[model samples]
Target: MISFSVDFWYAGIGAALIALSLLAFLLSKRLLKKLLAFNIMGSGVFLMMVGMAQTQNDGAADAVPQALVLTGIVVAVSATALALVVIRRFALASVVAALAAENKAAENDAAENDAAEKNGAERTGSDTAVSDTTVTDTALTDPNLNKNGDPQ
Candidate 1:
């Protein structure tokens, strides 16, 4: 008959957690999900370390592994915070870049319209009003423009 100790259970569970978390992390596309999976994997590592420590010390609590786990928890929390900040910045940058591209396209379109109107007026000797209304209408009707007529 085989005997399963508490230490063995802990190690087994920890290994399973590590494997599942690793898979989740790799398969996740979102930054937040990946971060959560990474944190779970860290927890699994701590559990495995504690289980190994107890096994090595004849089921007695060891100070080294406990201290290491404590330190790791602190570092993990700090790293998570840093990662969140980075993710927020990255999202903001992407939004800004997209808005800039839309604005550039809108500006280019307005310039082309103005140039075309000027050429048509010169050819026919007729004056066309290149007013703000024309530009505003173009901007307002644009799918890329926001409600305020700003390019999104």
Candidate 2:
């Protein structure tokens, strides 16, 4: 006959939680899902510590593991808050960068149209009018270009 105590069950559940959360963390792509998985992994670690400590002390609770878990919980909460702030800032930065790029493209198109109009007006009396086609040289316009006009 095989018997398992409550402590043993707790440890098993903790192990399972750790495994599942680890899998979720690895498989998830989004920052929020990864953060949730990290929190679940921390919970599993705390559960395992408490369960193992109790089992070792003959079903009696020990102060050391409990204290450690308490400290860990506080630290985890602080870390999670910090991570949320970082994720939000990163998301906002990405949006700002995309909007800036869109605005720059619009400005470029407007400048090109203005230049073409000016050229068309200047060439109105000439027999050969300037072509409407505009060619942009990315190498010349790239911000990363070095002082020597080479890509940095």
Candidate 3:
């Protein structure tokens, strides 16, 4: 009679995980998902290494592969942390760029509106009446004012 053992199951699971990792890495576009797939593939490799180290007759596990797996785990963790840092920096840079673009666009629109108002006043031959309801930006009046509307 043939017997299926724990090593057999581990090997099967490891193979499946590796296959899934490849698929995930290939199909996913985001950095986080790719990192997760890489971690999964590493785990699968570790499991396979352990499974292969199992002795057939004595059923004893080898120490070398276990040590290697432990070392690999540490390296993987370090790599993941570095990758996360890089991703965060990239995300921050993207946000800063987007905000800068938005601020520039707002300044341009304000300039155009001011120019239009001046032209309209010139065409009508009269000074435009400043309405009480018109609210002006603090930046336009006092250069010393900070972004939070606080005096510098």
Best by lDDT: 1
Clashing pairs in 2: none
Question: Is candidate 2 or 3 superior in lDDT?
Answer: 2
TM-score of each: 0.68, 0.70, 0.67
Instruction: Give the RMSD in angstroms, all C-alphas superposed, for model 2.
Output: 13.3
Indicate the worst ten consecutive residues by lDDT in candidate 1. 118-127
Global CA lDDT computed for model 3: 0.63
Model 1 TM-score is 0.68
**Model 2 agreement with the true structure over 40-130: per-residue lDDT tens digits:** 9999999999998898888787899999999999999999999999878656644443343344445556656544333332222231322
Tell me the whole-model lDDT of each prediction, alpha carbons only.
0.67, 0.66, 0.63
lDDT of 3 by residue, 49-126 (tens): 788677352447778888999999999999999989977865664444333334434555665654433333222222
lDDT of 1 by residue, 3-70 (tens): 76687679778999999999998877677899899999999999999998888777788899999999
TM-score, predicted candidate 2 vs. hidden true structure: 0.70
True-vs-predicted CA distance for residue 81, candidate 1, Å: 0.8
Clashing pairs in 1: none
